[model samples]
Target chain A: MKSLAELQAIKDKMKDKVVLREGTGEIRVVVGMATCGIAAGARPVLNAFVEGVNKENLSDKVTVSQTGCIGICQYEPVVEVFEAGKEKVTYVKMNAEKAAQVIESHLKNGNVIEKYTIGANQ
Target chain B: MKELSLNILDIAGNSVKAGATKVGITITETDETLSLVFRDNGCGMTKEQVENVTDPFFTTRTTRNVGLGIPFLKLAAEQTGGSFSIESATKEENPGNHGTTTTAFFYKNNIDFTPLGDVISTVTTLIMGSPGIDWVFTHTYGEKETRIDTSEIRAVLGDDVPLDSYEVIEWIKSSLEEEYDSFYK
Candidate 1:
């Protein structure tokens, strides 16, 4: 029951924030979407990141993409955030709700959610 | 995958990796069945490769020992009491190099077949990830139908517009949404 008018309004309102991703130092959020990841619920997680970034108006600052196996099938539905210079942060066992939290706390607030990070266990 | 659109995306990603310059996707929803077809002019698999593609233990990638996309799709189809198939001719197998075709059909009455997810996202993501690849998408329901060709859009927008731009993406999404909206009406 969604409408195109809604999407058009978003395009008009955020016209200025479009970031040309060519070395703009934009943050990259990659979802592991290979066979394992997809089977383990990566689609909703990917969708969450995409919708969250757009809703939060962080599209210019963050790029959402998908990648092949991250070599960790047990921790399926993995999401990795790569900032300009910081070490990449990998979040495992992610779901849609947790993805929204990542977008809000880590991406917007500039504070990594340590509890969700790969280092949480370490 | 929990959504049919997501499965389509994953399977099409394989076509992209096969060095396909173009991928044609067809979705037809009728009163009795929903069918999906993906045809790609890519470096196709050999018979041996095709035989093992649906096996969870087999994969061509060294990064992982299992390939789940095709196998999952097959399971989904069978679970719905539908059918699935993939056929391809390797470049060397033929002179003109006909490529791969993957197809799936699900009975409309089947409860296990996942509903088509956000198709607009699946399509735009395909275009964004593989720039310069032409995508011919066709959707049909009942007597109504719509077709979108990326090549045509590119011609209209010219070089001044990047296909992945926010405006372009919204435009494509809106157009598709509009078409589908009218179909259901």
Candidate 2:
């Protein structure tokens, strides 16, 4: 069994890192997780983002979160990325593979995959 | 949804929407039965709302005309020759005790029953989305049980650390993985 003592070790190591990132400008990745989003397979997309972010060591620079319906059920499984001063870029009809690509192109490279954005889909 | 875990995610999303601070999810499995219970200390709903929850047309949101989460869950459970129910006490009526409880039973032996797939991911996703909420998840099968409570982890980590931090999430994942490993052993 994994003990709480191990959790303490993790806390001790992460305490300084988390404290350092407070209020720092970072990119925000938000996934739509309402009924529409889940039905359209948002879980894997969300998972892919989380795993990808952690794999790339971007946890400190990019925060992944979830939100309810965005009033665009047709664009279910939507993802939106927000940088400090830029307009929010919403990506529609996303999947796990596409999520990885977004991580590589948009999050890691600082280039919005305009083709995947809701603007192009609409 | 293809997986019961997805249904769990969908249903619990309502609890998050209702401003729940504490969410409890319990899964109990017997030879022929798979039972699920989701309880939340949220804003709850009106009696009328509870009565109409299984109706696909009933929704509290103005942004959409249809709500399918409860209806789909009801259909999934009933199709397997099992049962589903929801009970709630609104804030106006129950005040400090307001919340919602949803119970569903499924005959696992039934051919049409959906599998509970990748529940660990569902739990982690919930925590990642709502780091402040207290989540208690327990899964019992045969003579073994696996459980995790965010409140306990929070007590150890202190309030300064977010539960969704990558390292914390990784720890949660590995811990659940270890417990689940022992379930089948």
Candidate 3:
């Protein structure tokens, strides 16, 4: 069994140094994680975001976080992408596979994955 | 919620938003039983509000109409061959006191008790990471018991940053996974 002290040490090491004081070209990926979002499959979506960012070695540039009810439960599991200076792009009804594409096209190549964006789905 | 811990997180979030000063969470896992109890010193709900709490369309807050969290927790408990109950006192023996306590119980099913630890950690992390909320989490497995206080973390954190920010989330995930690996199997 792992001790609490061991866990605390690990936590201290993983603490993020980058602060989002002024955005500074950082990419923010927020996943809805409220009850409806999770029931609709947000966990895998979150895992995908973490995995995709790591796989692309973009962990430093992109930060993934979970948010409570976005007041749009029907569209969950939703993923919102915010580039440093651009308008926020919301992706509705997302899954792990869609998250990967978002990374490949949007995060990497700077082109929005049009088909998965909220505008295309609507 | 995908996992039991997330359910606790949602409920604790509601308590903190309701202006709770202190929250208590207790998890018990033994050979025959698995139980989770959460109590808060927040604004207690009325009888009508309690009745409507399980209704998906009845919400006192303006954020959204669908209230699926408590109902989901009740269902999760029921599905695991267990039960759930909620108690509230708008004005108890004291002249003007109000509080609410919710407890959900589940029976063991030949699975290890390590998952209970994860559930406790999740609740602790969610409450600790949020601002202006204090939480005490107690976990019991047979004769062993562990208690975690968020104030300790707050002492270390000071006013520098929030507890549940991006970095803390990763740490919480990894720590819980490490403590409850067998349960996930």
Taking chain B only, the TM-score of every model is 0.96, 0.97, 0.75
Task: For candidate 3, give the lDDT of residue A62.
Answer: 82
CA lDDT of each prediction against the hidden true structure: 0.81, 0.91, 0.70
Best model number under DockQ: 2
lDDT accuracy of residue B182 in candidate 1: 86
Q: If both were scored by DockQ, which would come out higher, candidate 1 or candidate 2?
A: 2
TM-score of each: 0.85, 0.95, 0.72
Model 1 chain B: worst 10 consecutive residues (lDDT sum): B154-163
Candidate ranking (TM-score, best to worst): 2, 1, 3
Decoy 1 TM-score against native: 0.85
Which candidate model has the greater DockQ, 2 or 3?
Answer: 2
Show how many residue pairs clash in every candidate, following the order shown.
0, 0, 0
What is candidate 1's lDDT per residue for A1-122, written digit by digit as tens? 23435544555554444434332537999999876787788877987887788777777678888788899888888999999878999999899999999998999998998898877844
* Model 3 pairs whose backbones collide: none
> Which candidate should be chosen as best, given TM-score against the real structure?
2
The digit string of per-residue lDDT tens for model 2 on B1-185 reads 88999999999888999999999999999889999999999999999999999999989988888999999898889999999999999999999899999999999999989999989999999998888899999999999999999999989889768788888988999999989987866
Candidate 3 structure quality by residue, lDDT tens digits, A37-122:
86787767877886688678787678777777888887999999988779999999999899999999999989998788789887
Colliding residue pairs in candidate 1: none
Q: Write the per-residue lDDT of candidate 3 for residues B119-149, one digit (tens) a residue.
A: 6445534653354677777667776665656
